[model samples]
Target chain A: MDDGAPAGNAGRTRPGPTTARTRARVGRLVTRAGLELAALLRATGPYATHDPTGSRAATRGLPAGSAAPPPVPQARLALVVATAGALHGAVMGSFAGPLGALYSAAKIPLLLGLAPLVCVPSFRVVHAVLGLADDEPAARRAVLCSQATLALTLLALSPLLVVAYASSSRYHVAKLVNVGVFALAALAGQLTLARHYRPLLRKDRRHRLALVVWPTLHLFVALQLAYALRPFVGNPRFPTEFLRSDWMGNVYLDLLWSLRATLG
Target chain B: MPAFLDLDRLLRGESTRPETLREGRVDLSAPRLVLATLVCGAVFGLCLGLFAATGETSDGAWQLLSSALKVPLLFLLTLLVTFPSLYVFATLAGSRLTLLPTLRLLVGAVAVNGAVLASFGPVVAFFTLFTTSYPFIVLLDVAFFVLSGAVSLGFLSRAVGVLFGDAAQGGSQGRAKLVFRTWLLIYGVVGAQMGWLLRPFVGNPAMEFVLFRHRRDSTIFEALANLLRDLGDGWR
Candidate 1:
């Protein structure tokens, strides 16, 4: 009996390396899948239209001249920005565990896809109100530039964020800092859009109102979407779940409750 | 109405007249703002600390005193750690703001934060007096802090713009904007850690009043996670 037990124990220990190998394989598969998805997004995504010259000319308010600038493909810009955002999210998500990468990966498309969509109606309204209906192309360019700015800013900040997360012993502090970085990136993008929109608004005092309304609307939509797609970064206390069971609650209330529970 | 009350106007890029920030035509000095900030911060901290210690406790006075001291200390330490780096970055970005004005503006920001905190003192005290739920009080305190901090940051942005004039705006001002955002991040991280280190601001009525607890191995995140787990279990 004792001999048999020893043999069984040895057999059990043998699976350790097998599991590790399996994990490595899984990681590779996930990476391959992600790349494929990115390529697909680049190819067929609605955001991947090729109209760089029109966008550039409209944003700069430059008149058409004999020597038009070369057209920059929108697909390339979208692909680059989406990849950067996903990478940043993945790096931050790694702090939680392997599952965090999946959560964050899911978040990337939602954020990139939804934010601009949220702003579209507002953009249309503003354009109509400002009597810039004819300037729709310019407005579209402004929006794209703003998004690209946000993505690039996030990409630049990712290294610093990774370092901060790795070094910080405190999870609360790290999480807060991560949120702050994201907020700053979003603000930077919005400001860039506002700058582009200013000349288009003809220095109207209503420009301020439009700026506030658009961002506020965008944030509200983004926050709701984020809440719905919960667990972008898994909580250390609980096992990773793709979506929280109680995901219907208000984010502000969650913040309040979480603060009370943790600090009070 | 005073310029400070017109936050919307400020957000629209309207500048507060220089006379408002000056003393009899003399520009506001760093030392003056620093002194004023410290005083206001102390008042705000005292109100919060006292309210936190209101539960039945053997050492209520000690708890209140320590809480007050720690709150202001958190702000002061964050400022000290971030100021030099911010100044260097601003200068590198070609901001004409000298060290003195930068210090004044930062300290003034803290003062505005303190004022906002004080404004919520009555609401905090009311909850403390009536509610025995510790977590609820803690959450309310945090919410208040976030609200005040955001308002203060808005003021800081406007103040920087006013001080730097046109140089504070446009693409060329990217570096300066980056520095400001970085400083805000640093302040937040340092402040959170400090708050964690000097914790139990609202003493558990059953426990003895100890100024500082023995150091724990767990990080604030770990503690938060554990608390959340406990709450989840209770709910289930």
Candidate 2:
């Protein structure tokens, strides 16, 4: 967890060593970073394609470049989200989660910027994956996903972010941010792809396998990606109520922290 | 010519005079819900702005611009989100209950939530002055604002469709499919429109509101003090 690619480029700086937890976080980060890197591999899964130049400027909705980049937007988003997560893990390992501190009402900056911005890059993928048939629906879904993602993620990360900001207590705000970042990335990307597959079962429409197989595979792949990296996530040690509450809140590590640290 | 919620008599209009609910009532058909939603949108903007302004640039000139403008920004944000947010919230919370009461409940919830979260943003910022620390509190505040509003809106979304079928028309909602199609429309179109309309007026500045100094505390305090100095209603 702690060693996870040093989030914001810990490679050059090199995060310090071991406390089983930090190591776990690092492992996850490293694996995720590896997966992201792997996606760009010449012959591989999600990151298989590569188009340096545009195939006549992506007339329809495709980008100028090929799918080769594996969606830089998603990757970039994952980068920021993951880095934030890494920062959070480091905090947790250092101080443990806190209940309250200064400016306790401030929203999670890492997340606020991360989720929406990241979505921007993958907006098309998500919209298509979700079930966008018409251009209106496409744009509409894109907007909804961003706004909804903002509101929901904000709601979801609230307690934990609050607990984190309020205390000098090293809660795993960074790690939480990463998990959130990835979960969102995977879901956003995969869900969009799923929608792409919807029209497929009948006939392979506009896209060949890009529409059907890619999204379908991506769903499993995203989950697998998240799961593969799960080993590195840290328990931010939040309060019980908050910990037990919310979909994202009830995960393994957070559950541990909430039960132990939370006043309620 | 939409309906409004006036659970209490204070807000006057063509009243049904339902004695049991509260004192006075107003036009249930007024566009108050819409207004409230817009205001909520504004508040969301405010909370977002304040969140952005957390750990700002140390430049005095920039600080001057930011410090001077927070309350107004918050005020505007609260204002903009008023109507849409109201509609959204009313839709979320009391899905089972009728419209007026639903809006009333939503209104009350936001008033409390906005005031608390808004006030709290600065206080948290104040205390956590040292670290460019995580804006955890702001995050919570955002949650408070969103969840409270969302719960209410989620509940009422269906009601919106049922009660104001016209308003709810066009948006798709298949269980096996997507939802809040209209939600997407309004936010994107409206948000974009609002952004466009306000952009020219808003001094093409970067939307760099989140800095981390807890401007909400001092700025809010200053605004209150200014209001007091003006004896509540001074000129422009």
Candidate 3:
């Protein structure tokens, strides 16, 4: 599972290809890139109203009471979450090998998609208690939008990950870079959630409370799950495993110990 | 987590607004408020105890446990000691607020305090990881406590002002506020003393694990002064 090997072979094979074969390969790559870009635009489009199932049209047919955008279909949003998550995860694990890439690709979609599922029931109860139950559907959509935004942001950031992995074989540096990217993406997601919740907030001030509480709950779960889903960068010294043996350890405590070792 | 939403409303001034307080009670669930306080307090306590856990001591785990338990205990016990006096004086000051509402308000304030402390958990943990200096972590945690203390007091005083702000109770409102101000000072001192009694929250590497340190001759203020001096010496 040597990551460098395939790229090294690609470099060595570049000059040996005949000119006609090179042109055909380049044409295929161009078509693939075009399709990927279209998919990305569809995922990240701020006003993605082109619902093929006519559900968004049905939403519009109802006399609109608020200026909030129509909710994207749950299935489509789930697709975006999984696809974008896997794209970023694949690059994140590229420093390991194909198997490592597959494992991470699978784990990231779970991270992006499942963490919110874990949080939704409690959040719904919170919304009900706050007397904002009527707005809960919109709030759930906001959450979905935020998750989609986070995944798309990560997908957008995968190139930087590639650059970072190329420059550093050091696992610690790789981990740090991954952290920086995720933090930036999470910030984007929070901002998106806030923006989406703004319409609801105007209708009811209590939505403001849920806006802050949701992120706090989400990040608490997400961070711990990330800690459990360790070995994302696959330290070169160790075998490329899906998780470390002691994956269930407390993340905050582990972070403290690591920091002390590094700085003290 | 819903309990945290109650704190969110408190911090946002939504729950403590003049209109809301006029209804004669804060909108906080009693059980949730207590749960939030304990969880948030324990979260910060875990962060605080990280210094010891990462230090050259075998009592690291015990330190975390003690610190977690002591933090909530420190705040709740301090409130228990000081609340009765505040309630009596507030009533004597011609306030119309009764016992249950006042207690709920104070508990809400403590939950806010806990929330603020928990938010700073990561920052404390970061510093804990970045430095092995015992004095520095102690001082850092003290500074955070001071900051959170000010926030909780601010919340309490504002809510009390609105609670006492009835047009008919104009003069007594000022008296109630004055009582609150005086009680704040007492609370601060008692909190410090209580924290001192619950010592070893951040386990010292030089010491072994103990639930309570021996009753010391020195006071909390003196210990703080010593920590400040020691921290300054380390810097130099």
Clashes of each: 0, 104, 0
Across A84-154, the per-residue lDDT of candidate 1 in tens digits comes to: 77877787677678788767866765687677787797778886787655665555665665676567556
Sorted by TM-score (best first), the order is 3, 1, 2
The DockQ figures for the candidates are 0.01, 0.01, 0.01
- Candidate 3: residue A102 Cα off by (Å): 74
Runs in model 1 with CA error above 4 Å? A1-264, B1-26, B163-165, B168-172, B214-236
Residue B184 C-alpha lDDT in model 1 = 74
Candidate 3 is graded, for docking, as incorrect
Candidate 2, superposed: residue stretches over 4 Å from native: A1-191, A194-203, A206-212, A219-264, B1-236
TM-score on alpha carbons, each prediction: 0.42, 0.26, 0.46
Which candidate order results from sorting by lDDT in descending order? 3, 1, 2
Q: Write the per-residue lDDT of candidate 1 for residues B1-236, one digit (tens) a residue.
A: 22232222223323234443322111333333455455555665666666546766757888777777766765676677566446544543434344444555676666666667767877877778887765556667767877888887877776655444445355445556667766776666655555566676666565788887635443445655665665567567
In candidate 1 the C-alpha lDDT for residue A121 amounts to 79
User: What interface-residue Cα RMSD does candidate 1 give after superposition?
Assistant: 29.4
* Cα RMSD over interface residues, candidate 3: 31.5
Candidate 3 structure quality by residue, lDDT tens digits, A10-64: 2122444588588667656744443332222222233333333333322332256
